[model samples]
Target: MTSGPASSPITDELLVGALELERTDRGVLPHRLPAWARAQCFGGQAEGAQLAMAEAQPAGVRLALRTAATTVELDVVRTRKLYRGVPPRPDGVYDLLIDGKLAAQATATGGDAIHIDMSTGESHVERGPAATLTFTDLPAGEKDVELWLPHNEQAELVDLRADAPVAPVPRTGRRVWLHHGSSISQGSNAASASATWPAVAAASADVDLLNLGYSGAMMLDPFVARIFRDTPADALSLEIGINIVNGDTMRTRTFTPAVHGFLDTIREGHPTTPLSVVSPLYCPIHEDTPGPGTFDVEALREGRIRFTATGDPAEAKAGRLTLTVIRDALRRIVEQRSTHDPNLFYVDGLDLYGPADHDELPLPDALHPDDESHRRIGQRFAQRAFTA
Candidate 1:
């Protein structure tokens, strides 16, 4: 009989798509934003909590290694969010890929839980035991393997075990595509981490991905522009407008200049990079109406959560931003800037998920896309942005 699997400590060198790792009492917590960016959250109580949760979810993170082991095991402590009246969100999925193809998928058992009061904005956490996820009966010889962590869960890696020793996979020198957007790009409603639209697009385009998609937090902050200016990327894109309209964050006066400033900062570093400015996807509720989106309390009473825009359509004429207004402004801005910025590109977000597709694959909550929509968007984005 073969000997028991050998244990290995998880390390930074084996991780991909995470900017930093924090050591916790139980294990290492992967962070998409570096320490400097996380540090800025302090004192901004309103946006801080949302940003904290979004960045810690590790939407595109995974562990890459080469091993001959036919069996593998990973120990993790996962923290999931739960709303008081709503159903608990499902546990995040871990996807195992061998030789660049999806091989298997699994979810961790018992772990910590966080319950949040949506109405009061209060939260409490309860500690629980760690979980071990195992994968067995792999193909015999050594092969490159990747264990993609949950895109929507906060996971702390405790330990790793394999039937044979594991080593880091050598970098493949692939072109790096750095993308920034809101929850849609962060894998909201996607089936798994590897299935996030950006992840799927990167795979199809044969490029490495750096996803800076923060749920509810892509408001064109100066710090985020600085992050873009600093990071090295072969290609860059920004999925703007949705979060801006969702939050009703900026008006035309402020948004127009902010977009210019944001692009200028990125160009400071990536002067000639192929940069694409992506507008918001087709969101029916906010397509024509201005928003400060609100929850459907009636639906909440029925144990279903839904969102509805509270702002009036007339507000758009008064300079309040809606998806339509934002899209128009974005298109004009891209056209005006393209005269001097030859490398800049504009991608109409509606083309990714427009009204026609919405009728067939309507967003369950009236905001985020479902699994199938994510697949189509990713595939379409690959064709539009990468192929062209």
Candidate 2:
């Protein structure tokens, strides 16, 4: 199916990304979750706003090719959602990597955007259809190039073309870092595709990245554990806590066993893989207060969207989950497990984003970090967790 344009001399290569593609009339959608997990969504067993968001954003996915093409273009359908009170998100950016180094970047504009009224919980399409992204000029050689799709929006790969014939780049055989987490790790509000913290950290650590950061879907799902068990990985990290707090998913009692079960499943395949259990980043909204975060009503009325903690602070005593509560529990769990597991480790997420850093780079929407913060986080994580 990928056979270039009628007038072009070079061939087209659309099957460059990791996931299998599902074609629609307009374009092709990428799938990170495997068939079983997707079946959960399709069969109405896990239909919710969370899965809707997770499956859309190509958080850690990218397209790779080894070619001498001077110019490359991708026909893209960018799906952007605008919360009623929030500013319209910037156009999705495509980051290019050449020879395993950041080479160039571009944005996909004038694509289909969806305006969603968060207050009303309703959505409608904004006319602007799909657009083509073209990166031109010359770097004439058989260099390996990877195009990272935007991490924040839904992008349909309409088409891909280059000035020369292209083929899938051979794997570098570098250690694959498999990471799972919530929206922060999912690159929520991240500046661009390759700039997400995990992407940055992975590049800095010189590891092949397999990002499983499913927006709001990082709630210790057994199916995701299955993915971890089956997928090949050299190292693993679980950014735990934030989603549990904000989603108010479970209390300490339930959370403890869930963590054990999740880890046990992954260890089934990666018995000795270096597994790092990460605690939550510092967030004032849920530092001591339990969550079930809600939007700030007054801010929403003023054409702005911000999150506020709703759960009571005292609820922590009753085993309600909070950032502090979850962190402590996670540490204890890792400590206990490490007694029998030599490769297991723990990295405090606060070490990457603590109170001091929070004062310097606060979460913009009272939830997700902005671009500068993402850079700080990626840098700190690389320095702290991946040190020799």
> How close is every model to the real structure, measured as TM-score?
0.97, 0.91
The positional error of residue 27 in candidate 2, measured at the CA in angstroms, is 3.6
Error of 2 at 100 (Å): 3.4
Which candidate wins on TM-score? 1
lDDT digits (tens) for residues 170-279 of candidate 2: 66576788889998998888888888999989888987777888887778988888888988888889999898898898998899999999999999989999888989
Clashing pairs in 2: 4-12
Q: Assess candidate 2 and give its lDDT.
A: 0.81
Span of 10 residues, lowest total lDDT, candidate 1: 38-47
Runs off by more than 4 Å, candidate 1: 1-3
Error of 2 at 317 (Å): 0.7
88-202: candidate 1 lDDT, tens digit per residue: 6667999999988999999988888888998899989998999999999988888999999998899999999999889988776878899999999999989998998999999
| TM-score of candidate 1 on Cα atoms, chains taken together | 0.97
Best by lDDT: 1
